[model samples]
Target: MAPLIVNEIISPDTNLLIAFLIGIGFGFVLEGSGFSSSRKLAGMFYGYDTTVLKVFFTAAITAMVGMLFFSLFGWIDLDFVYINPTYITSAIVGGVVMGVGFIMGGFCPGTAFCAISIGKLDALAFIGGLTLGIVFFTEGYPLFEEMYKANYLGTPTMNELLDIPRGVFALGLILMAFAMFWVGEWAEKKFPREEY
Candidate 1:
């Protein structure tokens, strides 16, 4: 049975410790993959390096398939999984903001932290700006609260929303990820960038 914490098989402190260890490993992988470089990260948008796309796509597919198999094998309880509630308006706005920030800063939050660990000054600035953005958002929460809560789409899984079986949805996503990887490889060749 998975979700040991939810099932009360593991204490909350142990769960948190596990999460911290996983986070360290994940950060190490990110840094090893050259995610600490702002130019490399920004290359995703420039069509010069598609490694970012491939890495993230592969991760998504892996997680999706892993969870599907886990559920099928009764190793994990799907009902114990948490799905974040969808706030359509806030989601759209947040995506746009994050996209813009990614382009300008050349690092998402996770990657920024990775860069900071490697002593990147640019990443330090990015973190400062990110902190300011967070402060601004929190201070202005009351003003944005209405817009944030506008679209109240209750938590719904993709398969449930599309009225398809989980296996079918996972299959479709895996196929799509393959196609995207093909395109990404082609783009990298078409828009080649110097080694970082």
Candidate 2:
């Protein structure tokens, strides 16, 4: 199929179908992994349950390594993939705000939706707040637009910034994931709690 769907080889219907299937699988896995519970999700912050940490770290490493391998084997066209333009300071601030929100809400947007599917009232309230926040941000974009565009760093991969081989970065990431997994395990044992 000419390496990638970005080449317009796949029909729109097929592309969307593939996305729908993948989304369903992702949601199912999350729900099965106890991520649909606010208590369990919050447990990670409390060091009582580290399933969230392990699952997410594994997923990230897997995706990164898979992408690297795919690029190496000519399975996909990396150039056709969309990359977000990096605004260094704004990006750091945005990520901090996002982390704080996640800690407060006990559910990131994706898990909030998963919890809502399972009839969690807290998730419903979270969704309402998220919608309101989005509306406010859209309405007030002009006020923050300058700051949003302040740091105009072009999108560059780790290899580009660190001047290291892509494989080296990938290896370092995998090692870091493993180290964190070990810490997560220890945390779970140190603060063991019955399943929610």
Candidate 3:
């Protein structure tokens, strides 16, 4: 169905409408999960909660497994999937910045949007700061363009770089998620706190 969008089987307007609808559903789910609360989000860092980590790992594993099965059944063509280009330097820099922002603000961009919809004043401010940062990046693009484009590693995946079959990596990922879930559950017990 994704290729249908690229092949124009779905018109641009319909594609956009679909995206909007999906976004709404996603936002609703996030809000329902208590992700819109900054304190709950920040609790993960203090080890008082592990819902975020558990949910993230579960979702990742589910998607990986689902994709593998879908491809095996010929329900979806994996060949048409887009791979994100790996820019090592920029990725590290961006990740570090976002990590700090996540720790301090207790919300990533998506959660901030979800919070905003539920009338969070702090989330609104965070969104404003995020907007300003974007504007600054746009205005100062010339200064950062060189660093941004540096360390291009093409659209590489572990299966490609490691000389292994995709199934091997997917299996490893499932195992890793299980291990992480074990550790997360332990941490939640070890650092139990009254609910925020």
Compared with the true structure, the alpha-carbon lDDT of candidate 3 equals: 0.87
- Count of clashes, each model: 0, 0, 0
TM-score of each candidate structure, all chains considered together: 0.97, 0.93, 0.93
lDDT of 2 by residue, 50-71 (tens): 8899999889889888888888
Candidate 1 C-alpha lDDT tens digits along 1-196? 2376777878988888888999999999999999999999999999999889999998898998898888888777889887889999999999999999999999999999999998999999999999999999999999999999988989999899999999999899988988999999899999998887
Runs of candidate 1 with Cα error greater than 4 angstroms are: none
Among these predictions, the greatest lDDT belongs to 1
Error of 1 at 19 (Å): 0.4
Worst 10 residues of 1 by lDDT: 1-10
| lDDT (CA) per prediction | 0.93, 0.87, 0.87
RMSD of each: 1.3, 1.9, 1.6
Tens-place lDDT digits, model 3, residues 9-118? 78878878988999999898789889999988998898888888887788788888888898898766777788888899989999998889999999999999999998
Clashing pairs in 3: none
Using TM-score, give the best candidate's number: 1
